[model samples]
Target chain A: MSLSSLPSVSTARSTASLTADAAALPPRAERFGRALLGSLLPLCLLALWALASRQGWIGRDLLPSPGDVLRTTETLVLSGALFHHLAATLARMLAGFLIGAAAASLLGALAGSSVLVHASLDPLIQGLRSVPSIAWVPLFVLWFGIFEASKIALIAVGVFFPIYLNLASALARTDSRWDELAAVCERGRLARFFLIALPASLPAYITGLRSGLGLGWMFVAAAELMGASQGLGFLLTDGEQTGRPETVLTAIVIFALCGRASDRALAALAARLAWR
Target chain B: MAEAVAVRDLVVNFGERAALGPVSFTLAEGSITALVGRSGAGKTTLLRCLAGLLAPSRGEVKMLRGQGRPRIGYVFQDARLLPWLSVAGNVAFGLTHLPRAERREAVAKALAQVGLSGWAHARPGELSGGMAQRVAIARALARAPDLLLLDEPFSALDAFTRRHLQEELRLLLHRVRLTVVFITHDLDEAIALGDRLLVMAGPPGRIVADLPVSDTGGALLKRQVLALLEGSGEEALQSPTLRVLAAHAG
Candidate 1:
């Protein structure tokens, strides 16, 4: 009677007992559970950081406590400074990523389809890909100025090579049998591309897109660090100049959060694109 | 037994090098023909040409079916089902333009025909070798093709599965009444499946022997054929006509 007094708690206990074997769940559900656990790990780390700082186990000035970083983040959010910087960085990334992906796809398709294109451009692409996006920042700044163009250009260049390589390889390795079947069906070039080539290369394209997006973000951060009035990267530079560890930590946290969120968004988009 | 396919002086070359050529043949409709030869005897090349997957470098391949271009289907040596697609999807690949409901019905009918009704949703990679080959057959049959070309479709199967598929193929052919052109290295297969048996010679391939196996399925005819081959071997030593054919085939 005493245990039955809390009926809801008793029912919850019974449900928990029934669902004890977590491994019996479907793979998709299991994957989601694992991702949720991974998400919680960062929060746990933050809590631990806050605890250690509170106990004076770590210095607050050199490495700001989680509380201090949170306070700075909250102040920046209230004043609307963080939002402006976040928006700038995001806009640059978006513009650059789209341009890069489109260009890569077109050029890669050409290179993959024609022997002459491959013979002429493959070496050049390989050489250029070895050079980091940051290395181009100086020349980009000189040519395009400190405005949005330089930043976007730098990000686009950063994203281009991976997408190009993936697309080219995808085209090269297309199922010859499918192509032959299409030929037998009397499908022309355009029809073949839409019906077969595009769908066949979609998985590779999405994979490249994911990598490109990540690279775009990295390049944006570097571009912002070099020069930019309003961006998370600028925030880091400002914090360094003023010797404010809390502000620096806040900017870093925001950058990391945005990067992880963008990855999830891209992953969601990719999953939708490749639903088949 | 009207001629459905007629090939005259068919020459296939890979760039400058000839694979097989100057071989003339005719195939009758609603009957199965088997091309039996050693490896590199252009059996596959000939089948591929008949399937329209490969164009002969020189020669006329006149396929005579009364209608517009007849739908020709090919079953490769391997099943060649798309790994990403389910067994049903693989069968329905040629039916891509069909409406969803029609495709579903077609897929169900094909899977049922192949005795794989319950395994519709299974991926090609998940299936056994024999099951995959059945899926390939289903893929071809689903198209309702006028001519079906099979290149060693059951060569890799275990003895039981091979025999089972052979019987299934025979039944399917009877039900559909479609023309078949099969290529194989096995005499037993040629004896079992073929209406007309064509034996090919090496290098620039030519037809050395052509025989009608007729309705004989047992080994008696096989032994008789072997005896004839041995008897012919001695005849080749003396007769110039047999000598050239033997030399080229050897």
Candidate 2:
């Protein structure tokens, strides 16, 4: 009837509202300054850790100095041990992430589009989602036998739910107005799904991917820690068993770097697609 | 003008409740009609019926072709633009069935028609409310659909922008004769744009009065529409309508 009659206008779309105000980019110098400022806190933290270890405020047995951790990393890299561990973990995470994301998005899209599918699948998914990441470790290890398969499966589990939930909810919550427009446009079901539903769901889907990737890293750590012979997780165990604090610290630093790098890569992709 | 559509005794229900019609009307080809009503008055339901989005529970809406099959262009209350697409891409949305070169030409022409030349590359986020709405209108125009349906397309806009677009719509029509049906709560907007007016009212919505406005904005017509939409819809419905004899709109 009247525009006033509709429950709410969808002009304030969650997807658009986030980026609507971001029309203009900040100056290069300003953006560079912001990035420099972002690094300041971490740099300060590094300085403090180095100071603490040097002054004996924190003993090397407890927390190694930044220099000791960096030297250990250097040794690992030169000896090719770091590459071996990194490649092993990256490969596992990649496989797990691909499997988990593919399955989640496929199901999520179906559930989002149809009530019957959602009703059929959501309860089981929600129930499984509640089961702790660590809890799955024993069950997976038993099934896959304390090997790469079990480790990868655990990572996949971690990656799945965030993606599934985010994607499903996003697609499900898409503004009905677009559906009306599609009806008016006389779009086929396939065109509606791909052209309207998918694009509308992209922001949340990307957000889901980011969260899934983050959880993938966390679950990979847990997976490797539980039963691994060659990973950063294995390095953590090796350092712990050998009483080498520097080696553990090295592994932690590498994990942090890798996680940050992977997240940045996805974030870059998001930026490219975000109202650009 | 040929008859564009004939909606006869159309009724729509949402579960137990009647949402629209049990009313009847016919549309003239290349005519501009406005449906004026309060909230929940079945204006959108009727519009959707014409667009083939809603099926009537009773009665039927028949579209009588004049020449080639009529393509429909709809402008929703909100822009309903795809945020990922550029302004040109959004305009090109319906033109996907056309060849690429034809689609591109239509997009450029539609954008230019809406006075949005050189805005092809701008993202939806970059545009203001008025600009975005203009892009939406351009998107509708790019399809070159002879039957145009707008649902309060300018109501969400500022008064100045709304008035500007209203005038622009009239100007655009001068270049191409098309049948247009728009719904608005604003009596003034209905009178300003419509060649014929369908004033609708109620929870079980029906047309209370169907009136015509002359080229000069209809002041007398506005008062009747306002009264029909005021409180209980029955005031106009129970009374033997003047237009039933004079207009014979149905």
Candidate 3:
């Protein structure tokens, strides 16, 4: 008998159920409306800020007027200072994230595959995990000096732990059934690790990477506050010392936007790579 | 018939508790043996031991092999497809050592055998349970194993899906000519699928009865097997037909 002639009982059932679920979902316009509704509060707050500044209710020295901040932002953009600082911060963030994520994933994979390695290293990792990234900043500066190395080291430390811990746990928690399947297939140890273990642990690994990226941004800012002269964090400190509220607000805004953009990008990449 | 699998005093233990054996059996080549037992009767343990997933606490299992490496295919209760891989990719998983062209051909053949040729690019997540299980079977089939081991492969599906796949699998097995040992708790499924039916009973788990299934006596054999499963050991031993079956099995 031809396979095509056979009735697709389960497939039909699943398809019907999925169709019903899709039907029950809110329409596309309603989803768009909901997203638009979510943005209302933020827009309202921005409007209020502008209104108060226009009414002279907020002192310009203490809190820059929206108009003044906008003017300052335009000046910075035209002068290319904003781009230079933004590029510096972004470069530091990417470099630190790549270094930290690479090392953590490699170490995590090793530890996850071997119980002895995990047992030996887990306590040390767990101990270091509790210390804030800022706490390591002074020590890092002392050791590496207040150059790009210290700042990069600080961000890397901040990025490393989350990826390491999550990836390790993910590897440990990999469904034993997959290993059994690999064994049954007569897959070699290297094949099992690369094909089964690595892919199986990816969802958790991606989660770790995303968290690490967010922390990377935070650590880069903190590191720059100490001895950096070119990054956004430097801009923040410089603004504070000069009592330029506009500059400080600009730095904060840029950081918020960059953080959000990087997170979204990471999420997109993870979604593409994730099994589920 | 040549023996495809032979076992002697196989035993499996977890810590202090014995899970299976002090049991033994020889399965003929190109035969389907259904292992029926109550839940926790160590049927899975026995199958796992045969697959070399778990080491036996005592004794040995030997498969009849000629010169080359032994190939064993295992189908678990779950489909166990790597969620990231496409259907073709999953089927071709065990064929990684083969040349790319051979691997693709093997994957295509396996998928066709399971009637999933059209779904080569689909992800496992998109597949229905029965379809996913079929993919799992195809994955195993791609390896062209000497022996196939299935642990309640159809038990997770709905009755209709299970029944459909059982028929499909029976046909597939006939075409492939592979030796198979499958575990199940359903008496009817055992009767329907197996050339030989082995019953396991116990706290420590041992095979109590092994019957060579003849096509003519299926209903009667099923009833006797059900009785032996439901009744006490003394009653099972007292049944004359069961006695003959057990004697024939030995």
In angstroms, give how far residue B140 of model 1 lies from its true place.
2.4
Task: Report the lDDT tens digits of candidate 1 across residue range B1-250.
Answer: 8988899999999988889978898888887888876677788888888878888999988889858876877888888776656788778777755688988898888777777777788766556677788888888888777788899998987786676678777777777788898987667877777777776666566665666775744375455344434433234235554444444333
Q: List the residue pairs that clash in candidate 2.
A: A1-B44
Task: Give every candidate's TM-score on chain A.
Answer: 0.85, 0.90, 0.90
Q: Lowest summed lDDT over 10 consecutive residues: which window, candidate 3 chain A?
A: A1-10
DockQ for candidate 1, C-alpha atoms: 0.09
Q: Judged by DockQ, which candidate is best?
A: 3
Model 1 reproduces a share of the real contacts of 0.06
Ranking by TM-score: 3, 2, 1
Of candidates 2 and 1, the better by TM-score: 2
True interface contacts retained by model 2: 0.40
Clashing residue pairs for model 1: none
lDDT of 3 by residue, B1-250 (tens): 8988899999888999988878988988999999997887789899989998889999999987544667888999999999878889889888866899999999999999998888899878677788899999999989888889999998899897788888888889889988999998777788788889988886577888988888788888888788777855456667776687788766
lDDT for predicted candidate 1 compared with the true structure? 0.77
Superposition error at B78 for model 1 (Å): 2.4
Estimated TM-score per prediction? 0.80, 0.88, 0.93
Q: In order, what lDDT does every prediction score?
A: 0.77, 0.83, 0.86
Clash count of each predicted structure: 0, 1, 0
Off by over 4 Å in 2: A1-24, A28-33, B66-70, B223-234, B237-250
Error of 2 at B214 (Å): 2.2
